[model samples]
Target: MTNTTPQAASAAESATAKPALIERNGIEIIAEAERTAKPRDLFWPWFAANVSVFGMSYGTWIFGFGVSFWQATLVALIGIPVSFALCGLIAIAGKRGSAPTMVLSRAAFGVHGQKVPGIVSWLTSIGWETFLAIMATLATATVFAKLGLPSGTGVLIAAAIAVAALIVVASVLGYHTIMKLQGVLTWITGAVTILYIILTIPHINMDAVMAIPAGSPQAVIGALVMVMTGFGLGWINIAADWSRYQKRSASDASIVAWNTFGGAVAPVLLVVFGLLLAGSDPALMDQISYDPIGALASILPIWVLIPFWLTAVLALVSGAVLGIYSSGLTLLSLGIKIPRPAAAAIDGVILTIGTIYVVFFAQSFIDPFQSFLITLGVPLASWAGVLIADVLTRRVDYDENALFDANGRYGAFDWISLGTLVVASVIGWGLVINQFADAASWNNWQGYLLEPLGLGGVDGPWAYSNIGVLVSLVFSFVVTLLLRRGKIRRQEAAPATDGDN
Candidate 1:
């Protein structure tokens, strides 16, 4: 992919300036050097992002359903690939449109109307950032305790603050810094990940672990949703934010394959390690923490604990940085009109407070994390459905300038696209049932589609198989296509009416 297409428009500027690594590309067309990433470059960035306890706990969650290690690993093996592929697929928009995913959506949702999804995407990014911060803080505190320091409220709060602040600093440095950090840390984290798997091999009891029964079909389905929702759908909103840096000539297939494989490496391997740890021991659930580092300490030697703990903390911080950076982009995409770095700083501040509360105050991780992922999946998946359909059907032949102009051809509001997003989100909400969450946690779930509506019988299957996301994807796609068909008809008719006059 030679981006030899001559720097978007400004040839002279492309030759003179090396592109500001920290500026905003949220609402503007990505000019020259900013479009420097290749398809292969995406491999490590994604690898570093997925290598964390944030995703590890999801693997550990499978044991809560009483699935065997082998069975749990099977579910993960199936789900992780499916989810990561979506990341690759969604990333194509970054290259094709020469903009962030949220900016590209302006072609779908209209300039002003996009604020709705933009806000949702913003919250999604912030939610991820905040959640990752909480995990990192707790992980660090747990590690400190293992090292014979305080893991009490004071220590937890301090760790949370420190981790959140560091992430913010990295994030405010913007795109290149995050990628560079990830590139370098990918090696450290990758080594620790390998060491983790190696240590776990010495403890594996294949006979007993394999004997753990696969649960009922309903339960299996629920576990599938848990793994897929936690890993896959959670990433949909931010796919383009990272991929937009890929040169325009980057291979679509390479982008998808690299993203799928690279992103899958750490999560799948770590989750497998987690599932095995749980399935091998009956007392596993008793030791499970929101941060899985403590749980690892219980099984591995104390000598192995510190490096694993420290690396886990670092990976979690990296994950949060990705979220912080993208949340800032989404904020700008919402038409905030602020400098990108400033937007990132503002998000960092909020994340700091959120991290403190979740780590020190809330003192609970699994419930919130599970519910958060389920809640985020619906709207994002539905939104992806719209864009996927548009790309496939050629509905995405957009005018780059018109995307930003409120009075231009795309307009300030596109009721058809906006309405599709709304309806799809509603359906996504309804069918989504938090499989891992208790009834109390269920009440707070965004995917709590059935309870408030008061439909018991219908809720059972809907919650079990959870077809809401599927329905949202297909429904939005079909609806958007129909709307485009109608819009084109009207446009053609207007020309005839003028001719008649």
Candidate 2:
């Protein structure tokens, strides 16, 4: 040891050091795999999880509302292809880059602009997670009350315990674990729901369903659109959260197709079941509105009802878990230095707070909670639109090194992306805000402008708010094209320099 030279000693130390498997910026990526190892994801499990998450888009409420089930079915069937294409285009960008949605947003927004969307996603998810927790509690209580525990305080307590457990379980695992759980939950929940639909079908009043009139001709169109647009807007904004775990080699288009298809179509059966029950027994519908549990219990056998209730509760937990995990990823992508577990903890806490709000004081907070999500659609759509433009312009390729290089191609303020996002969001949001301002607001406006629509006058923005989602997408793409033209012109205008320089 005394005779060893400094060079030899240094070499020995180097030889003993463990090689780092992955690096990002200055961060080590050791949780899952080595840098060279392609992402290992539970493909089918993840796929089923996504489908389940998407199914919640049209779960219970649409059925409970007692609208035309066919309208919802049509909306889901048609909207799936369109929404899937948009989600697929954005997802492909994330897939090719091996980046999450927020990380990819950095290419379009400056690192500064990146945070706006990140916070938006984070805050929105917190509210949603809370809503899910509350809904789960409500659903659990409803199920128990139906089972003869009319007071349901015990049911509520049990539901709270269950929700806490789900958080703990979801917290301990990583993406692989979550995906597997979600897959099993989806099948169980989906099967139970489908069975409920089959059983409930015989109870529907076909004559009343036919005579329902959709609440005037115009209202019918509006309700129909609402059903379609509602397909997955609530949580679909975070599709990338789960999809990011998907192996890059998987055909993303297929995932999007299935995701959109499952999300859009599966709930229609549930709605049909609900509608049949509502149509056949209007008195039962009215009674259960105040006591939803009692209403459902009467329709379902004790065995059928218990599993159905459990399925709904599990589904709620599933949505909350996905939201929390995705929010954590978005935080990480934005350069938060916390450990993944710590990040997830922050989400759980936020969700817990939201759950409290829902469980103890739901009626007051619930309306605004839903409105907030409706408002979020514009911005989420805008970001999604920019993502599509960025991908299409680059011909579906991004240099991996550029993501780390400060002065690299992906760096910089993409004015086109930013500007397009802002403008589109404003225009789309205007559609929502104007609908409420005044009837005079619409009367004096340009005749050519489309009026905001809603569901049978039950909700505002009677038509599909998804129009905002669609418009934001189209406008962002068009603006990106305009900016691209300007970029090309400016590049040609400048004098040439040496390639190395």
Candidate 3:
């Protein structure tokens, strides 16, 4: 007869019992038994979050760079996939480490040093979530106006509250709930988005679009940077968060493939279509500059506005949910002693406050806010470069225990990686220019090296070309690869903690 002690029986029961609807996992390594997620599972969240009609606004934004339809199309085609592929590469770390991205980053930056990037990651996530919430609220109010409802400040506030609440609830409920919700949202939003495209097809004037003049080479590069920063780099910090639940046995190539495919497919198609429409109509481009989703609604028939608005708002919420959820994990990795759900709620509250300020109080918020996020993207790309190098060099799986234990192999701080991040960011800032005329005066502090580098000063031909993001990424990556290979190999060979076995 098999004898099972009470302790064993209880443990077995706990393991076999259905997981709580609310996700309890935080920054810790996912338990092996629960790592049942497949590579294809990554498709839903990425696809749903990115399928928003707002991607079409990139068409207008790219054209604003003075690029022709063909040049803009080339930029979108190259930039979107390449950027998300970086995300895909980072996602490989998740399957290998079975922990949140920042947690796994401890391998490169050390336990204490990881906190530096962690703070940036947290702030970036919060900023992104808030931005999405603001967009959704505005989209809601605009749609209501189209529907002949009162779309005043009060309505905007109500919409903000509603959007914030929805994002918070889904994020707090956590991963499983989010995954299921994203799967459903993907179908709903995708179908509606397709309908939106079909309805707006007649608006595209191919001849006018073809007649648009081509921008300078520098302008093409600038448009490319915009597409990348707006799409992939925006989400790279949290790239691994969604994949942490993937089974350890999952193929890394598959992880990258699914992530890249899911994220790139929609944006590429949407942005190209948007380019056609915006290139054809200058007035529509102006409308999109101020209000992306609502402007798209302006082109559609009154009958389809409701569905279009609903899909756009839902898609925005889907993105905010992903951001808030990852931001919560990032919070915990920062040593915040709170449950994941509570952390998500905290970010949601912050998002709500930010939305209120932007919608109700701030004047000319979007341009500055966007420019600020893009500026921050320099450091983020630097961090990503360091982490990607570390991931590529280390052959063994992350020492899961060492990731949390400062005294272990990963150490308390990695000076090489941290130093690389700082240097790269400094150089990067000097290379990029803040093109937003309404941006804060401080933003002009960048591009200081422009004249020295002979790239023309801030007002030169390369002024719009944000080459700093790429420079930071490449510089940090190469430096880390050259310097950290030995350290990573030694760290990997170190003795595993008793629990790790």
Which one wins on lDDT?
3
Q: Work out the TM-score per prediction.
A: 0.88, 0.75, 0.96
Q: What's the number of clashes in each of the models?
A: 0, 7, 0
- Give per-residue CA lDDT, model 2, range 314-375, as digits (tens): 76677678777777767775677776667777777767666665566554443354346556
Give the per-residue lDDT of model 3 (tens digit) for 1-501: 112222333455447556789988787767666778999999999999999999999998899889999999999999999999999999999999888899889999999999999998999999999988988988888888988999998899889999999999999999999999999999999999999989889998999999999999999998998899999989999999999889888999999999999999999999999999998898998888877888888888889988888889999999999999999999988888888899999999999999999888877666887678768989999999999888888787887778878888989999999999999999999988877855566687888888998998998998788889889999999999999999888887889844431
In what order do the candidates fall by TM-score, top score first? 3, 1, 2
Candidate 1: residue pairs that collide: none
Give stretches of model 2 more than 4 Å off. 1-70, 150-158, 215-225, 245-248, 278-298, 404-406, 433-467, 485-501
Cα RMSD (angstroms) for every candidate in the order listed: 5.0, 7.9, 3.7
Model 1 — which ten-residue stretch has the worst lDDT? 492-501
lDDT per model vs. reference: 0.72, 0.55, 0.89
Candidate 3 weakest ten by summed lDDT: 1-10
Question: Relative to the unseen true structure, what is the C-alpha lDDT of residue 454 in candidate 2, on a scale of 0 to 100?
Answer: 26
